[model samples]
Target: MKLQQLLSHTRKAVDEYQMIQEGDHIAVGISGGKDSLTLLYALHGLKRFYPNHFELSAITVDLGYEQCDFTPIKELCREMEIPYHIVKTDIAQILFEERKEKNPCSLCAKMRKGALNQAVKEIGCNKIAYAHHKDDIIETMILSLFFEGRFYSFSPKTYLDRMDLTVIRPIMFVDEADVIGFKNKYNLPVVKSACPVDGYTKRQYAKDLLADLNRQYPGIKQRMFTAILNGNIPGWPERIPYIR
Candidate 1:
């Protein structure tokens, strides 16, 4: 997607949900992946002209992978002039080597989020931005339906009362295809994930299933997204008048 289109979608979500407030300091969770890098770029651009005026800090939770190189990401953060932090941990060793979890994604995600939240708090950030896009939202809903027997997806804005952090998804309206296009067009410092089960996960299964469903039924994804927005799911912020 073009930069303008990205900004439009991001601003729409941010405005509709009031994700950013005056004097807000947001810590973006960067996983050294395409989605997160695209988010960083979008948020950086939004920060420039956004009327509310907020600050940004790019953060990454290192999963203790020796091969995971973050040099390019660091350089990109430098160019963007956003403070970057990487919380190094033995999460990989704990999940894969020590525990040998059959489903490492769940535990790994919990630990990673815990570490990321702590880091964000230490840096005095009240909000944390996740890189979940439209596809992720739908896929997560499907995953919950198939596995947990619930029809639910994440909200655009959520309050983590326990941690005193607000989570926002500014790019929730952007499609995965658009994210890929933006990443390639801008030559985002895309780094390969060194995790052992990068592509082999239940979420991947849901993604592939969604692709197949979209292929079989055209415009199905768009309909699903619209349903998500208007379905009145709990925790979804009602759209409010946006004031500059």
Candidate 2:
């Protein structure tokens, strides 16, 4: 996907959810993955010409892994002229070495997010941007139903009263396939994840199940996404016309 196409999709989501306002400062959470990198590009580009005139900064919380280097990400942020920060923590050691938790994703995510959120607040950002896309949305719903016995997914926008932070997902309209395409086309400096269970999680299982279901029934994923937009689930914003 080209940059213009990415901008179009991002604009649609932002407009639908009223995500950005004039003088808003958003911190893009960088995970060194395709989805987050695509989001970084989209938001950085949008900051230039969007009517709201928002500011941006990039941030990443390093999970104390030896092999995961963020030099490329730092260079990318420098090239984009966005302020970047990397919060280092001993999360990997705590989870895999000390605690030895069977399910580390939950604890790891909590620690990482807490670090990221604290960093954002320290940098004086009122909002944070996450790179979750369409595939994540569908997979989350499937995971919820299969594991939790409920129809649930995250909203495009959320407000945390405790932190006085608003989380916005501007690239929620983009697809995982397009994220991969954009990453290749733009040569995004993606830092490989060094986590032990990178692709061996429940989320991966849900993704595989969704792919199989989509193959057995074409357009099934689209239908599921449509249901999410119209499902009236608490926190889900109304669908925008541009999406259809």
Candidate 3:
């Protein structure tokens, strides 16, 4: 997808959920992946002419992976003129070596988000933007149903009262395929994940299952997304126009 198309989808989500406010500063959580990079570009493009005047910054929690290089990400942020911050932590060591947790994704995610939230708060940001997209939303619902026997997924907007921060998914309307296309078209410097279990997690299983189901029953992904929007799930904001 082109930058304009990305901005359109991002703006629609932001406006629908009232994610941004005047003079609000949002820190984009950069995982050095296509989704987050696409979000960075989308929000940067949206900042140019959105009705609300909001500031943008980028943050990445370095998991201390030796193979992961962030130089290109820094260059991209510099080129975009957005302030970028990297929080260095030994999360990889803690998860894999020290703790040796069998299921490290949940704890690793908590640590990463904790680090990210602290950094974002220190930088005086009122909101944090995550890059979760349409496919992620659907996969999460599937995971919930399969694991917990419940129909639940993350909301587009969430308020962390304890942290005094609001989290927003501006690109929730964007598709993962579009994210990959944007990365390829724009030559986004996507740093390959160095985690050993990068593609062998429960989420990955759900993702594959969702893909298979979508192939068998065309438009199943869209139907699932529509259900989430209209499911009246707790913490979900009021329903808004469904944008592609």
Clashes of each: 0, 0, 0
TM-score of each predicted structure versus truth: 0.97, 0.97, 0.97
**Residue 19 C-alpha lDDT in model 3:** 90
Candidate 2 ranges beyond 4 A from true positions: 238-244
Clashing pairs in 2: none
Lowest lDDT 10-residue stretch of candidate 3: 235-244
The TM-score between candidate 2 and the true structure equals 0.97
True-structure lDDT of candidate 3: 0.93
- What RMSD value applies to candidate 2? 1.3
What are the candidates' C-alpha RMSDs? 1.4, 1.3, 1.3
Overall lDDT per candidate, in order of appearance: 0.93, 0.93, 0.93
Give the candidates in order of lDDT, highest first.
Answer: 3, 1, 2
Candidate 3 lDDT by residue in tens digits, 1-244: 8888998898889888889999999999999999999999999999999889999999999999999999999999999999999999999999999999888999999999999999999999999999999999999999899899999999999999999999999999988999989999999999999999989999999989988999999998999898898899999887567465
Look at candidate 2 and tell me the lDDT of residue 70.
Answer: 97
